[model samples]
Target: MTTAIYWFRNDLRLKDNPSLMQACMAADQLLPVYVHLPNLEQETPWGFQRMGQHRKIFLDQSLQELRSELRDFGSDLVEVPGDVLDVFEKLRAQIDADVIYCEQIQAPEELEQVALLRNAGFKINPVWQSSMLDSQSLPFQMQEMPDVFTQFRQQIEKNKFRFAYPVDHLKSIPPLPAIDISSTQSLGRNTISTGGKFQGGEQSAHTHIQQYFERRLPDTYKQTRNQLIGMDYSSKFSPWLAQGCCSARTIAKQLSEYEICCGENEGTYWLWFELLWRDYFRFLHFKYGKKLYSPKGLSKHLGNEFDSEHFFKWSSGNTGESLIDAGMRELKKTGYLSNRMRQIVASYWIYDMKGDWQAGAAWFESQLIDYDVYSNQGNWLYIAGKGTDPRGGRPFNVAKQTLDHDPDEVYRKMWLT
Candidate 1:
């Protein structure tokens, strides 16, 4: 009987997972595994934990939910903590599995892991399913893809790009080849209060999407998405989207249905526009590769300086600028901040505080439960004037932002005091 390993990475959910389906098709017996890499606890050069408490807690909740879902299909997720290479090496020896199926992550480190496995003589089949539009369906080839978001969006819209229909959940998965999991220890199993509005899981992701559409949230999304507070201000899909609890295509598909039922408006269209932005960032990583992680970023703009003191104050919500402080505090406390707040704080770090954008990006990577590498790096680069933005960089006036967004001081008081 043929055996294959379904290695879960960012793409955690089974529903709408093309890679998981491919794994099931290739093997009569499957080993579904999630290796919580030890690197998560290691510190970055910026001197912060790679994964902060907030993201760790959410990831734990997500893993638990994934395990429960796997059980329903007569399979179990092998929870292990260690180096991914080492864990997989042992699993391969035990099961004699030669093939591994997983999602393709374009980020440098993630790509490195796949490379290591492939070099070790394992056949790695990586499906590109993270974006709303499949790569093959794009009007231009990957290399020929436009460098700017506006150009990319225009071409995609002109070509009438469509998202793939989400795959259905498997009724039953292949039985696991029995192997000892005794050496494996669960990484995020400890119960901890998330203290955030969002919960992690495939079920929760779908439920949230259902409710958002049912209540016509998309119709008002354009207007309220920039708000500093309130659950209904935005779709709040990023955390789930970041963890792969839901696919961007699935969200886009639902939004299309919502528009058909409720009559299309600018609000509903804006949500699609935002999804396009997410797709753009993901594609940008593929186009630029390792440059996204560098201090100079895509544009190779030099002269960036690291200021530990400024970063510490900015990250700890002690930046002294009320708006910047409020946003940082909300992120520190909730593992979340509105999209508008993210831009404002990021601009303040890069322009106002004159700190290294890479340090700021690393801090966000450590903190955000919803942090996607592409968006995090892309946004930082944009703010630092080292990205694809034609305007060079964005500099938000903190005083004006405070006056406009929080004139009543309601948001400021809630987090500052």
Candidate 2:
């Protein structure tokens, strides 16, 4: 009787999960688990809850739906409260599972988790399934991939490479092991927000994309993607994508079909382009790894020093720069921010405020429901001129940003009041 543990990482949904499917095929009895990392409960170096209320509430919502889906498969999701090793050690004692299966995360910390588990005599399998394009299918080896975004996109287009298609959802998960999940292990009650702009889960993700396409939003994505306010202006798909409620392949496939039926235009092409950008960041991690997390990043330039006072003002929406303040407030309150506004606010923090980019990124990490580690780190490094393209850094003029994106003060007024 084979018993194996299937650990849920960022890839929360069962649909299109190759790793989960592998576990089902290999094991007779499966124990599905999601570890609520203990670190999230603590404070960051910048002095804020590592995981803020907005993100925690969204994650709980995602886990709730995942649990329901697993129940439908005659299995249950055991929410364990601890770090990877502690959680797995306890599970091993309970079930004596044969192996562990999970989606591979290329980030340093996640990689370290897997390494530690393997060193401790755990048989682990980590599958790489997060990006729209599989790393193996890229035109060049990951290490040799272009440093510039345009070069990466050109290679993809030049070779006519497209997205990896999503797989079907498992009809049934393997039955649970005989061992029962103790009630003591639960991560408390699942957080349910009274009302919020974003709800996280597989069902919510699919419903959102269905409507987004049905409304023909892609037709205008290029034009409206840069808008400062309103959901209709952008895809608004990041929150779900970040949490792995939806896979990039699923979105890309839907986009391809949308193009075939509705006819591809600048809008459709641009959406795909954005997806490529996301893939670029993911692949870059393969080459750079922990260096991306460094204060100097890939460059020799020393990053700015942290000023607690400036950080407070910028993060709390009290910076007195109307545009930056409004964006910060929206992110803190709604856990969502327009992409255009993100670059603007980040630029302001790095340049005008002369603040530490690492602190700025940490604040975003704390607040954004849509925060993906790769993109968050990559973008902050880009703006601070500490990344691969660290050519003098990206410094946006607050005056120009204000005039260009929020001249009407409509966005500013909406949040400031």
Candidate 3:
């Protein structure tokens, strides 16, 4: 009996999962696995956990739901704790697997893991299925892509490229003999220092998506998307999308359908536009690998690091700018922040503090539950006038941002002490 292991990295959903589907098709017996790597706790150059609590809670919830869904598919998600390599090696010894299948990742440590597995003689198959528009359908090769986002977006639109609809099913697998692996053994609810917050999961993601589209999308998205107030302001899909509980294409598909049924407008279209930006960053990562994470970034390198005291003030949300402080405090407390607040705080870090942008990005990595490698790194560079941003440097005028987004001081009161 041929056995193949489907390792769940970021992609948690069963629907439209090309990597999972491929595993089902190629093997008679399937082992779906999720590895919780302890390396996530290792401190970066900045003294922070690589994976913060917000992201941790989201993944935990997503994995629970994914386990239930896979049970329906005549399979189960076996979770493993410890280092990824050790867990995989242990699983391989027990399952006698022929191959390992996972979603492709461009990030540094993730790619390194793939290399280690391949060196161990396990055939690794990674499928690219996360983007709104598939990489294969792009107008030009990633290397030959345009320098700026406007040029890239215009070219793609002018060419009239539409992404394929999402598939709701995974390929059927004949029930594989159950392995000795159990989720409890693989996933432990360890006490993580996250300033006392609960983790979010697939159930929350689904609920948020349903409510946002059904109740909130119609009235106030365009006007309120920039609002720093509450949850209903925007879709809040980033946490799910970050962990692959949902895909950009799935969200975009829903948006298009909603637009058609209710008549299209700037608000609905703007959501898709942001999704496109998400897609653009993913592709940009594909185009440029480790360079995206470099101190200099894609545009140019900055031989800079953060001032110890300045970084502490920024991370702790005590820079004295009420709006910026509020946003940072919200992130430290809740592991979530509105998009406008992210940009506002990021601008404060880069332009205002004159601190190293890399340090700021690292802090966001430690704090944001919805932190996707591409978006997090890409955006930091953009704010620092380093990435694909056209005019470059989205410097926030502190007074102007305060006046525009939080004139009522509602957001300020919530976070600023």
The prediction achieving the highest lDDT against the true structure is 2
Per-residue CA lDDT of candidate 2, range 45-83, in tens? 888888888888888888989888888888999988888
Of 1 and 3, which scores higher on lDDT?
1
Which 10 consecutive positions of candidate 3 have the poorest summed lDDT?
Answer: 190-199
TM-score of each: 0.98, 0.97, 0.93
Query: How many residue pairs clash (N, CA or C atoms closer than 3 angstroms) in each of the candidate models, in the order given?
Result: 0, 0, 5
Clashes of 2: 0
Supply candidate 3's per-residue lDDT for 248: 75
Model 1 stretches astray by more than 4 angstroms: 188-191
Candidate with the larger lDDT of 2 and 3:
2
- Residues 266-371 of candidate 1: C-alpha lDDT, one tens digit per residue: 8998999988999999998878899877767777567358878878899999978888899999998888888999999999988888888888888899999999
**CA RMSD of each candidate after superposition:** 1.2, 1.4, 2.4
TM-score, cand. 1: 0.98
- What tens-digit string does per-residue lDDT give for candidate 3 at 375-397? 98888888888887777678989
List the global CA lDDT of all models.
0.87, 0.88, 0.79
